[model samples]
Structures are given as structure tokens and as C-alpha cells.
Target: MHDQDRKLLQQMFEAAVHAAEPGAAMRPFLPARPAGRVVVVGAGKGAAQMAAALEELWAGPLEGVVVTRYGFGVATRGIRVLEAAHPVPDAAGVAASEALFAAVEGLGPDDLVIALITGGGSALLAAPVAGLGLADEVALNEVLLSSGAPIGAMNALRRILSRVKGGRLAQAAHPARVVSLIVSDVPGDDPAQVASGPTVPGAGGRAAALAAVEQFGIALPERLGSALEQGEEPPRPDDPGFARDEVHVIASGAKSLEAAGAVARAAGFTPVILSDAIEGEAREVAKVHAAIAREVVLRDRPFARPVAILSGGETTVTLRRTGGRGGRNSAFLLSLALEIEGLDGIAAMAADTDGVDGSEDNAGAFADGTSAARIRAAGVDPAAALARDDAWSAFAAVGDLYVTGPTGTNVNDFRVILIR
Candidate 1:
């Protein structure tokens, strides 16, 4: 029974992820062949795949560069595919950003720049501001990641620190008509928030970025802090630089959840789409989902049995105690397992749509009636693991880690609970 449940959950997850693949989802949204040069540039987990999709559909001559997370690249002709670090910016990304900007150089109003923006683009398009270095930016990113700040807050801080992000990229390509195709990974599908709005106009200014640092108690390096406080603000919505730019969210977490729902319905289960914009600390979100699962199983108040509850959106993890290894999805499943308390007739799966959870090889993990017991039997304490923020180790000990390698796409997290 547990094996059957696992298979069903995995199938649903794959369906959700497959729905967001750039190859299939991005084609219809591709703009018509440009009248002049098409300077293709992009950054994100899915940028390479998005470029591949563009190459397949675009007939006109085009040339450009795109940077993707390490190991996420695919072979493409005409457009250069460069691999770079993710979750944190590295020197390679810095160089790639320079190349991307150069591709748009000397463009006129007749020329077009197709910018592929998606999750992780902020890191992949890492171009530190004039006063800061790559090391300074990396340090700041580390602080923000562990600070448990929401993606929006972290991105606002990033926008202030970057030269290529927060609408500056669009500004640099002035006079060239820019078309951005984005894959949304954040709640609300704010184009400006995704990838720090490289081509889209941004909302917050330096003041907001400073506020995030204070709110999260993030200690900025002295130099970086000074830059944020003293430097000019990033471009705002009314910036004329974005007048010739268009941004489109071609794929998002909501669409992925809908795809999962269809798969659940076909499998004789009623699927309830909880929300595509769910947010909070990873473990806290798990508890809420568990409570809903219990309600359905114990009281049948919200929905009947044989139902699947699906949710998407990114969840943050505040690192309290270090030395624990795990991503948000694995941490969420570990917490969910504890709350369920080995309840019978319930199974759950939590995974990142991008195929790597919290910098680990596993996309996420599965938790069923036997998960907690299995971990305990293996001499691993579930509560202890959660306390250390080490859900990866807990899932690993139980042989439940869901490794999907690189899916070449990212729409944040995908979570589902099945009550039978």
C-alpha cells in the first residue's frame, strides 16, 4: 500500500513539473520573428531550456548568451549557453552577465532583445554593483539565505546590489525593444520579483532593501551596507528605460498545480488545489497542511477521503542550528511526518519543481504512514533532525530522498497530501 501511494504521488509530481517545462510551455508565448537583430539573453534555472525552446521556434537569425545554474545547460546553436553557480553568485555568472550586456550593445529601436527570465536569475545574472565585489555579494546572499527572509525581501536586497538586475539590464539595452519571457517562481507572479526583474521594472528602491536587511537582522558587510545606504536606488516602475520592454509570465506554480490536479483526478482521487501562493517557514507550512489532512481524514469537513491536496509556491527556512543538510521540500516533509504521527491512510510528498531542493541533489522526499517509524528504527530521531534543520539526513536515513537530478526548470516548491 505504501509503495502504491508513493508511486501515485511521484506521478502527480512529475505531471506538475512536466507542465512547466520551457520547451512546451514557452513556444506559444514566443514573439513573432524580429524585424532586426534578435539579441537573446537569459538567466535562471530554466534559461537554457527556454533558449532551446526559442531556438526551436525562432526561424530568424539570432545570437546571444544565457547563463544557467551549473549542470542545467543544454546544447544550443547560435545562442551561447553558459553554466554558472546558483543560490549564490560566482565569478562565472559575473562574466556571463557582462557578455549578455554586450550582446545588446549597439542595438537600435528596430532591434529586439528577447530576455528569458526565471527563478534563480538573480543569482545567475550576478553583476555586483560598482562599489561591491563578487565576494561581497556572495557574503550578502549567504546572510539572506540563512536569515529566513522571504524571497521578495531577499530579492529586493539583491536588486540594490546588482548592476544587471532590477531593471538595469533593460536600461542598458536602451532603444532596443526588449521582450521578456519569464517562468514565475514567486507568489503573486510579480515579474519584477522573479529574477530581480532584470528586464521588468522594479518597485522597491534602496530604502526597501535597507529595510529588509534590518528586518532580517542580516549583518551586511561594512562595504556592502555602505553601498546600499549611499548608492543610487534601482530603477523604478515609471523608468522610461522600460518603455520598449514587454514582460510575460509564461509558466508559474499555479499552472503546475493545475496539472498535478488533473493527474490526481485521473487516478480516482479528488484533487483540491489549496493554493499556488502558499508561503511561510517550511516546517510551519507543513504543520498547517498536516492539520488539513487530519481534518479530512478524521472529520471529512473540508473534503472527502481519496482526495489529494496540492500546493505550490516557495517556502523559506530559517536556520536556527547549523550543520543540518536539507532543502525546503525535504524539511517540509520531515515536519509533516512528525505532525501526522504515523496516521494511517495518509501520504505526502514535497519537492521543488526545479528538481533540486535546498542545494541538495534530491528534488524532495516522500512521507507516508511508515516514514517516521522507519527513521526512528534507523536510529535517527525525527524531532532532533528537525531541530537541527537537517531534514535531508533524516530522509536519507529512511531511504526516502526523492532525487530527480536537474529538471531544467524551476517554479519553486510543489507539495501534495493524499488522504485515503
Candidate 2:
């Protein structure tokens, strides 16, 4: 009986992601370039697909390299695709990051560098700051990852210590006009933080990184501390490297939200897109969602019955709790269940369109009035699991887990709250 809603939910999520795909979204933003060799260099979950899009629309002989998360690569002819680890840097990521910077070096003014920047580029395009070895970067990255720091704060630190991140990649392509087509995954869609702004001069200064490190309580290496203290920080728009460059956000959370709303409407529910810029801790956001769901179920004040609250944006999951294993979406759904208890005829699904939440294998989880009973039947205490941040296991036991592997596109996250 509820399978219709579940299918609709899946369609909405898939529609949102599909709307943001480089294949559909990249063509209109493409820039016309004069006669020269077009080198497509990029890194992110969408890098390979974005590269393919550029290859298709791009006039002239196109050749380049783009790095994406492992298993996220799209088939492309002109541009070489390399797979690398994401959210955490791996050896392949390190090698590709180096090769990309080196590839664009010494290109003439006639040469064009099309940098396809997107979410997950930070780790996929890693380049250690000068005087810091890759090992040093890796160790510090492990600390930062587990610290539960926000992506912006984490990337701010990474920006300072990289020769390729921030505005450095654009710097490397000096005299050659660089155009960055970004698929935003960060809150606010700041091009600087999206994929660590490889071709864009970022907005973060050294002081900001220092503050992030201290805020997150991440143990830093000696070189990182020294670099943070001494480094002038990356360039911004004022820098000369940015003088002849441009950036186009081919996809964003807002666009994806609208796409989801359209899908819900097509499925016979009046979709209300709350906002695309929703932000907060994952579980806290879930509480807000719960409140809205309750209002619709009881009073239906802000919206009528059968309101489907839709939103998009990245949320953080601070793991002050120990041994947490679930992603932010899972945590959000788990928390939503707790707040609403078991409201009748209300259901919700939250998932990252990119097919990952935290380090978990599941996209996210599903929750409704029956969630409490399901948890009890599974012999898994919801409160205990929530404490451990293992909502992935909790949802799995209840057969409410969502797992869509590497959707080959990233448009931040999509969430649907349905009441009927």
C-alpha cells in the first residue's frame, strides 16, 4: 500500500539528482573559447561526468584528465578518467592531484583550461602544502575526518596547505583563461569551498583555518601549525590569477529542490519546497522537520494535509558521541523518529543524492510512525543506536534503509517529508 509513496520518494530523489547532472546542466553554461588546445582538468564526484559533458559541447580537440571518487567515473573518450578515494584522500588521489597541476603548467594564452570542480574534489584532488609530505597530510586528514568538523571549516584548513587548491590551480594555468564549471555540494554553494575551489580563489584566510583546527580539536602536525601561522593564505578574486578566469555553478541544491518539488507534484502531491539553504546539525534539522510534520498532521497551519516539505543543503553531524557509524542523513532520520514518536500517516526519507552519508554504505534511512515498533521488534534499542550514531544498522534491521551506490552526480542532499 505504501509502496507508491516509496516509489514516488525514490523518483523525487532521482529527479533532483538527474536535474543537476552535468549531462543535462553543463551545456548552457559552457563558454566559447577561441582557437587553442582545450584541456579539461578537474576533480570531484562529478568530475568524470562533467568532463564528459565538456567533451560533448566543447568545440575543438579536447584532451585532459579528471579525477573522481572510486566507482564514480563516467565513460568519456577525450578526457582520461581516474578514480580516487573521497572524503578521505588515497594514493590515487594524491597522484592525480599532482598530475593535474603539472599538466596545466606552461600552457600558452591561447590554451584554455576547463576545470570541472564539484563536490568531493577536496580529497580527490589533494596536494599537500609545501614542506609537508603526503604522509603528514594523510595523518592530519584522519584527525579532521573523525573530528566531525564542518566541510567548509575542514576545507579551509586544506586550502592553506595546498599548492593546487584554493586559487592555486588557476594560478598554475597563468596566462591561459581558466573556466570552472562547478557542481556545488557545500552549504551556500560557495565556489571557493566546492571541491576546495581548485580553479577558484577561495575566501578563506590562514586565521580561519587556525580557528577551525582549534574549534574541532584536531591534532595538527608541526608543519601544519607553522604553515598556518606563516602562510599568507590562498588568493581571492583580487588576486591576479583570477583576473582572466570565470566560474559557473552548473548545479546547486536549490535547483535540485525545485526538481524534487516538481516530481512530487507530478505524483499528485502538492509539493512545497521549503528552502534549499537549510543548514544545521543533521539530527537538529530532523527535529525541525519533525515539528513541521506534526503541524501538518494535526493543525495543517502552514500547509494543508498531505504537505511534502522539501529542502536541500548540506548538514553536519558532530560526533561528540563515541562509536557513531551512521551518516548525517541516517542520523537526521533517526532523530526525526525520536521527536515525532509515532505520528500517524506521516513518513519521510532523507538521503544524499551522491549515494553516501558520512562513511556509511547507505544513502540514508526511512522513518514513519511504525519506526518505534520496528526498532523494538528488531531488538535494537533506538535510543542506544542513536547514541552510537549507528542509525544505518537500526534502519537496516527494520528494512527501511536506502542504498543507491555512487549516483555519478552530486547536487548536495535531498529530503522529503510526506503527510497524507
Candidate 3:
């Protein structure tokens, strides 16, 4: 039964990923061929794949450059694909960002700029404002990741610090018509929040960015803080420079959750889609999920037996220490295992749709009623692992770490629990 449940969960995860594939999801959102040149530019885990898809879809002559994470690049003819670091900015990302800025320079009003923005672009397209350097940006990301702030708040801060974010990319191509196709990984499916809105404007100004820093209790370097206080605000939605710009969210976490629900239904389980915009600390969220599962199993109140509960959205992990091993998905699964220890007929899987959770190689991990026992028997303390933010090691000891290299798309986290 454990093996069968694992197989079913894996099938649903794959279905979710397939629904967000760059080629198919972007097909319906492609703009009409432009009268002048079509210059492509974008950054994300799926940027390279998006570029490859665009190259095959559009019939006109188009050429440009896109930056993606190191292993996420794909073969492309007209659009040059560049690789860079993710979740943190690096020198390579800086160079790629400069190239992206150069791609849209000197374009006429007749020219069209197709921007393929997706999740992870905040780190992939790393162009610091004048007062900040790449090191400053790297430090900013490290602090933000450990601060336990939500992605929206983190991105709001990033938009203020970056030269190429928050509609600055669109501003660089002023007078040219810019169309942005986004694969949203943020909650609420806001295109402006995805990748910190390289082509779309942010809702708030520098005040919002500072508010995020204060709200998250993030300690910024004195110089970085001053820069945030005094830096020029990025272009807003009302800016005339963006009058000709158009934005479309081509794919999102909601769509992925729906795909997973269909797979669950086909496998003879009544699917319940909880929500696609869930956020907060991963462990806390797991506790709530466990409580819901317990209610369904013991009383069958809200949902009867033989039901699959599915959800999507990016959950954050506030690192207790510096050298944590797993991403939010793994941490959530580990926490869930602890809550449902020895409970019968409950199995769950949590994973990132991009095929990489946090900085580790595994997308996530699997857990069942026996997970806690198996983990304990492997000579590792489950509680200790969770306390140290080392959920990957616990899952590894039980051979439950889910590893799929570079799925070429990023819709966000996919989580499902099955009870019978």
C-alpha cells in the first residue's frame, strides 16, 4: 500500500509539472508578429526553455539573449541562452543582465520586445543599482532567505535594489511595444511579483521596500539600507513609459494544482483542492495540514476516506542557522511525518515544480505513516534533523528524497496528501 501510494503521488506531481511546460503554456499567450524587429529577453529557471519555445512558435525573424540557472539551459537557435546562479546573484548574472539591457537598446516604436519572465529571475537577472555591487546583492539575498520573509516582501525589497527589475527593463526599451509572458510562481498569481517584475511595474515604491525590511526584521548593511532609503523608485504602473507595454500570466500555481487534481481523480480518489496561494513557515503549514488530515481520517467530517488533498504555492523556511540542508518542501514533509507518526492510511508528497528545492539537488521528499519509524530505525533523530534544518539528511537516510534534475519550468511548490 505504501508503494502504491507513492506511485500515485509521483504521477500527480509529474502531471502538475507537465501542465506548466514552457512550450505548451506559452503558445496561447504569444503576441502577433511585430512590424519591426522582435528582440527576446528574459531570466528565470525556465527562461532558456521559454526562449526555445518562442523560437519554434514565432514565424518572424527574432534574436536576443536569456539567462537561466546553470543546469536549466536548453538548445536554442535564434535566442542565445546563458547560464547563471540562482537564489543568489553572481558575476555571471551581472554580465547576462547587462547583455539583456543591451538587447532592447535603440529600438524604434515599431519594434517589439517579447519578455519571457518567470520565477527565479530575481536572482538570475542580477543587475545592482549604482550604489550597490554584486557582493551587496549576494548578501541581501542571503539575509532575505534566512529572514523568513514571504516571497512578495522579499521581491519588493529586490525590486528597489535592482537596476533591471520593477519595470526598469521595459523602461529601457521605451517607445518600443513590450509584451511580457510570465510563468508565475508567487502567491496570488501576480505577474508583477514574479521575478520581481522585470517587465512589469511594482505596486509600491521604495517605502514599501523599506517596510518589508522592517517587517521581516532583516538586518541590512548600513550602506545597503541607506541606498534603499534614498534610491530612485522604479517605474510605476502609471508611468507613461509603460503605456505601450502588455503583460500576460501564461502559467501559474493554480493551473498546476488543477492538473494534479485531475490525476488524483483519475486514480480513483476524490480530489480536494485546498488552495494555491498558501504561504507562511513550512513547518507551521505542515502542522495545519496534519490537523486537517487527522480530522478527515478519524471523523471523516470535512472529507471522507479515499481522498487526495492537494495544494500549490511557495512556502518559505526561516533558517534557524546558516548551513541548513533542505528546502521548504523537504522541511514541510519532515514536520508532517512527525505530526502523523504511526497514523494509518495517510501518505503525502511535497516538491517544487522546478525540480530543485532550495539549493539542494532534491525536489522534495515523501512521507507516510511509517516514515517516522523508518527514519528512527535508520539511526537518525528526526527531531534533531528538523531543529537543525537538515530534513534532507533524514529523508536521505530513509531513501525518500525526490530528485528530478531541472524540469525547465517553475510554477512553485506542489503538495498532496492522500488518505484512505
Best by TM-score: 3
Clashing pairs in 2: none
- TM, every model: 0.98, 0.95, 0.99
Residue-wise C-alpha lDDT for candidate 3, range 252-355, written one tens digit per residue: 99998889899989998999988999999999999999999999889996999799999888788888865669999999999999999989999999999999
Candidates 1 and 3: which is better by lDDT?
A: 3
Off by over 4 Å in 3: none
TM-score of 1: 0.98
lDDT of 3: 0.91
Per-model CA lDDT versus the true structure: 0.88, 0.82, 0.91
Residue 150, model 3: lDDT of 91
What TM-score does structure 2 among the candidates reach? 0.95
Among the numbered candidates, top lDDT falls to 3
- Structure candidate 1, residue pairs in collision: none
RMSD, each candidate, Å?
1.2, 1.8, 0.9
Number of clashes recorded per candidate: 0, 0, 0
lDDT of 1 by residue, 92-121 (tens): 988999998898888998888999988988
